[model samples]
Target: MNLSSSLMACLALAPLAQGARLSDRLESAHGRFLDDRRGAFTSLSDPFGVPPLAKIVLEDPRGRFSGPESWHRNVVSTVFWVGELPSENNPTPNTASAWDGNWQANFGGYDHPEKRDGFLPTGFVPALNPFYIALPYNDIGRDGRHRPEASTVIPWFWEDYRGEGISVCKDRWVAIHHEGRVCYAQWEDVGPFETDHFQYVFGKDAPRPNRNQNAGIDLSPAVRDFLGLRSGESVEWRFTHDREVPAGPWRDWSPEPGLPRR
Candidate 1:
């Protein structure tokens, strides 16, 4: 959605209170935030033009969309919830451990070959690069081998869109695998310009879960059919594994010619 429409929808959800001043500091921070890495692949014409971060404006007492609140003022206050894994190829332990605490706390958890010099910390690894750090989340502690389920809010960054040159927006919800790796998925809505609508670009060779090997598995077809998607449509998706059932028994649409209909 365009800025105006998005603003209108946010306003409708929670209106701004009277006399509330927009935080200049927050605005400045957002303006300076980098949307994508310098040399990352993307499909958008301007990868950096999108805001790397967004302030979550809560409704004011007056029920109007007005100014910034304390939550929005603190740049690091943004939070995201951990969703289920998307593929059967479970990530290794190293992948899941990285998302244990406040996402910002684990900034430098991963290692990379090409390092940039600047505001980023010396040991920092960009979470956007899934090959390095899997997903974004906060950890409770580092004592045990247990994988706990908890929700947290923290500063978030986006990866450069592959080939499209666009970057994922911080406002969107992301999926996190047990390995700590993360991926972006969009929600369904009325149209491309709708308030809840989002655009996403998936990487080639992305993993697909085999819930039912007998169902004739192919991620693209399953995802397309599951989301009621159209050709060339962009979407946000997340996968859930049903361990209770056998992988081969799952039913799915066939993409190949002469394949049995499921």
Candidate 2:
């Protein structure tokens, strides 16, 4: 069937999806998604019926889409960390983050962007959760002031804003898909390059062209390992609420105190 027919089937069978896999219900209707990750599927574009992350949004009465704020498909992703040294490929060392002046210290150690011990750094245990990522947009500006566009561009701005000091984007959980695996991570820092591309971050637009293969997001080693991703790979991702995060290795480590857990 086509996309519209598949959607109609989804709504008609919504009750059946309860306490059962939605992917299974939609499989007969759409037959487009085939991934085995948590019964979720991957797609090349939108409205190809609902992927698992979008399933959560559809189930939640409060998270209904008002615009193009669902999954960002086929985005180029790169790897980065708290103390990644400056190099030819990476001009900006991550000694300090856009929000945290002492990112390494706060994170409790060097992330060793490359070294991995099965979803974690080989040398040390991270004081915070190892699963983290960075998007290309920063809500705060270089002038140490919240950007004017942040309030309007970010969907959760009003709901998540604590004050000017805390970032609405920081530590926000995201669900990522690569191959057949889906891994969860937090938004800890910003950039593979640009930091003002909110249009692409929260709106419907492609990533701005950049040197790093137009990387739209940066993943931590833990996220990279869990997703089995190479340095530059295409993946699908979407902002997810803490309550929606599923049980996985991402929760095997500790998150900073007071942060949400699933």
Candidate 3:
């Protein structure tokens, strides 16, 4: 269904401050789904009900995101794009991943650079990976379902949106809102931490173990740089449907078949 005239006006301009607070949006762009006819951000605070979006802070878990071994469930990055690697040392690692692996194809068909001796170049992982987006997912099934594995080589974490009957997708579009900049990126992967935390990502309640780390979302190097997020910085973001996405690197990059919904 189309947005109501008033809502459209609000979306075109700045969202109203009184619109139902989610994270920090003065006004969100919550619309009524044509299928279910349910308002996206319906809140009890709104007498008319249903605000647009929420402006809550997101987490850029770069430093404190720790784990035991390479496969140790908690220390991986959620993305695998090739870029300068960020480490937790006084000096930054002037290095990047040699390979940009595919998530759906099991990291298949990639040009792996030869490792310098047994030692990974300056600041890369043992497998020669410069960096990884540590997500809370372990799902390694080809069927697009959640299974949750712990192998760094498994390349398994993209969950089946349809498995849970949700609409999230790999490489899905998202709008990240910061101090005043609004950067756009694809949902390349899930998490800086806590993958199964559905309520935090989509539902009304905030993400878990938050208030401390306050990590609800993870951004890739590009996304983080675009939004200018500091390590462990908080920002607001919302999922943008395919139809609403604008054309950019996120839209024009390599063709993304994406994970099977069902």
- Using lDDT as the yardstick, the better of models 1 and 2 is 2
What residue runs in model 1 are displaced by over 4 Å at the alpha carbon? Answer: 1-89, 93-135, 144-226, 229-262
Top lDDT prediction, candidate number: 2
Per-candidate TM-scores read 0.14, 0.71, 0.39
Model 2 per-residue lDDT tens digits across residues 66-156: 2245889999999888899888767888978877888888778898866777777778877777898889899988777789998888877
lDDT: worst 10-residue window of model 2: 32-41
Instruction: Give the alpha carbon lDDT tens digit for every residue of 89-133 in model 1.
Output: 332222222323343333334322123233122364333222111
Off by over 4 Å in 3: 1-168, 210-212, 254-262
Clashing residue pairs in all predictions, respectively, total 40, 0, 21
Per-residue error (Å), model 2, residue 242: 0.8
Candidate 1 has its poorest 10 consecutive residues by lDDT at 70-79
- Prediction RMSDs, each to the true structure: 28.2, 22.2, 22.7
For model 3, residues 176-262, the per-residue Cα lDDT tens digits are: 667687665655444444545543443345556643365656555545555555556666665444445555434434345432111
- Compared with the true structure, all predictions reach lDDT values of 0.25, 0.78, 0.39
Residue 42, candidate 1: alpha-carbon lDDT = 62
